[model samples]
Target chain A: MATEAQGESGGGLEFHPMDQFIVSPLFGDGGVAWYTITNATLWMALAVAAVFALLVMGTAQRQIIPTRMQSVAELAYGFIYKMVEDICGKDGVKYFPYIMTLFMFIVFSNFLGLLPMAFTPTSHIAVTAVMAFAVFIAVTVLGFVKNGAGFLGLFWVSSAPLPLRPVLALIEVISYFVRPVSHSIRLAGNMMAGHAVIKVFAGFAAIAAIAPLSVVAITAMYGLEVLVSFIQAYVFTILTCVYLKDALHPHH
Target chain B: MATDTHSSAGDGVAAASAPGMPQLDFSTFGNQIFWLVLALIAIYLVLSRMALPRIGAVLAERQGTITNDIAKAEDLNKRAKEAEAAYEQALADARTEAQRIIAETKVGIKQDLDAAIAKADAEIAAKSADAEKAIAEIRAGAMDAVRDVATDTVGEIVTAMGGKADPADLAAAVQARMKG
Candidate 1:
């Protein structure tokens, strides 16, 4: 800590982008237990509260001619509902609640993380990986439960030549396994990268001569981060729908 | 400003040795993942139980309302169109009735005028026939009176000449002169 302060005093640029991402205890400083109520818990609870505020309390009145908040809620419902129905078909609509949960949480986390001095839960590999693995495991189980032995058809490319089918199937199986990794990493990486870039640019603002340009870069990156936040949530939800589609109709 | 912000923000977790990437710090994975699962579960429960159904119902109700309103509007439009059609029908009926009445009146007037002309023609023909009969009778009477005068003059001439003439012969001579 003294060295960081010393580094700052020496007129060197300070970059603590990961400090914002650290999952430390909200109260006393110690090892983070599994049950510890850390900043991650606060922010996660905030995400839950946000979801509840918007989805539950915001639409409590349930007016036919909606208020602005209710309209936003309805828009979100329609958007995710249509995605599930479109990608996974009508049968997939049953899972709309689950997909919607993931979307709302991730989206809220990303946006809330954009707030100054806020921790991004989605930026952590552990959090996103848990979600991605949950989806992967659930979809796999659902596929096998629904299709039995036919669930393996997801790997077997019937359209390819009989000789090439084996090679294609190998690649397909590997990619199938990689879905969770890519899914989790894609979100976490985008969040981490954008935020880290913003922090780096913010660090550059310590230079008096380039402060204006750094501020401009941060502003631009912030705008792009806002877009990425929503888009990542959308992509995650859509991919979940796609995976669910594969589970429901594994033959295709 | 940047140093102040970085130091203050960093002071929260500066107690722990700062990892290059906090995301890879497996020590905190349990905490983040556990909270994330809790949040996800909480959100899922909230959405599935209360929020989703309410929003779904509201959307459906709104759709129903919009559909009902549109249907009502369409019904009103249909009714309006029917009313206009009925109005046009009534107007046509009135025009047809008026034309029929005018045609009927014209027929009646033409019939009455024809009957009056026929009656006048018949009355004038009867009057002329009666007048011709009277004139014919007067003309016959005038011829008879002339013949009679001729006969009397023949008789007087015979008497003044002192000739013993037969009455029949005189009469025959008068008749012949008159015939000529």
Candidate 2:
């Protein structure tokens, strides 16, 4: 489908490091109107659908004994509960639902992308940047709402010497701006690296038919990528929590 | 080289814009993201408004049940202690009444035995005194009768036998025989 999209090119385009990062057209132009969905979009949709189905099923019965589905629902609820409580303190409970959705969506998206022929929307810089930007906007808005313009004091630590205040404030502002960049890049980099390594090792399977040694290396890499997927999701969620903490109580 | 590069670029552009080809980043993804966010908002609303309230209600119900159980247990404990105290009081009262009855019965029996014993002792003394008096009277009357009989016999014998006998000596002899 991509070949069809790039119609004339059989294999002429040069591959760059950035090529691994960008999301190109998944299917070439086939006049299907707006009906054509890309693989990334599909996986993303599936993640959303899965989340809905799980939540709906989990809560539909509301049993006292708790069926497996209900338990799964409760587990998710409990996990997010702890996450919010630990990060935002008792007050964090109010935001539990939102944070739970965020964690599940990112985790499911990352895991889904590990499958064969699946596109990781999160692997795209645009997608991650947008998520990061949303978080940034939310945290920023929350800060102002909670602290009013006094939130500006978050950047200027009065504890610093009077002479160093301006410089420290500048640094703080720069760091604050860098939050979204780092947040987005962290997720994007981890996802792209994992997918690239997996693709490279998988490519070796074609050659491993001739060179048996490549099989062992491919197996090890596949195992490593699997571990990496879970770790990336954890890292993403934890960093999100830490960022939210800074927003909730900005100081050091 | 310029011509080759230009013609290939032209070909690439032509391929990219071919009929029935949709443009990349044509807001398709943007629309999807928008819908996804909207759906997310809807889910969040439902959870917060419906599901969350129900969960909270269940938890509150559980807490209420626990509280009621504790309260009931405490009430039962209080009742049990009261009953135990009442039972002990009843037991003590019964013990006191039994002791009183036993002592009263012992005293009553002792009184009846002492009264009967005193009455029998008095009767035996009275009968012994009367027998002594009666015996004395009998002795006196017998003595008198015996004297008369002796006198008459002595007189008759003296006359027949031609021997003299004195009245005083005969009486003395009779009396002496009686004394022996």
- Identify the leading candidate in terms of lDDT: 1
Which stretch of 10 consecutive residues in model 2 chain B shows the poorest summed lDDT?
B18-27
TM-scores of all predicted structures: 0.82, 0.60
lDDT (tens digit, per residue) of candidate 1 on B12-107: 454354436777777788888788888999999999999999999999999999999999999999999999999999999999999999999999
Q: What is the TM-score of chain B in candidate 2?
A: 0.51
- List model 2 lDDT by residue over B70-168, tens digit each: 999999999999999999999999999999999999899888888877887788778877877787788877878777787668766876799788888
- Candidate 2, lDDT over the whole model: 0.66
Interface RMSD of each: 2.8, 8.2
Best by DockQ: 1
Please write out the lDDT profile of model 1 over residues A1-252, one tens digit for every residue.
454465557767676655567676777756689999998999889889999999888999989889999999999999999999999999999999999999999999999999988888999999999999999999999999999999999999888889999999999999999999999999999999999889888878989999999999999999999999999999999999999999999875
Where model 1 places Cα greater than 4 Å from the true spot, the runs are A1-10, B1-19, B120-180
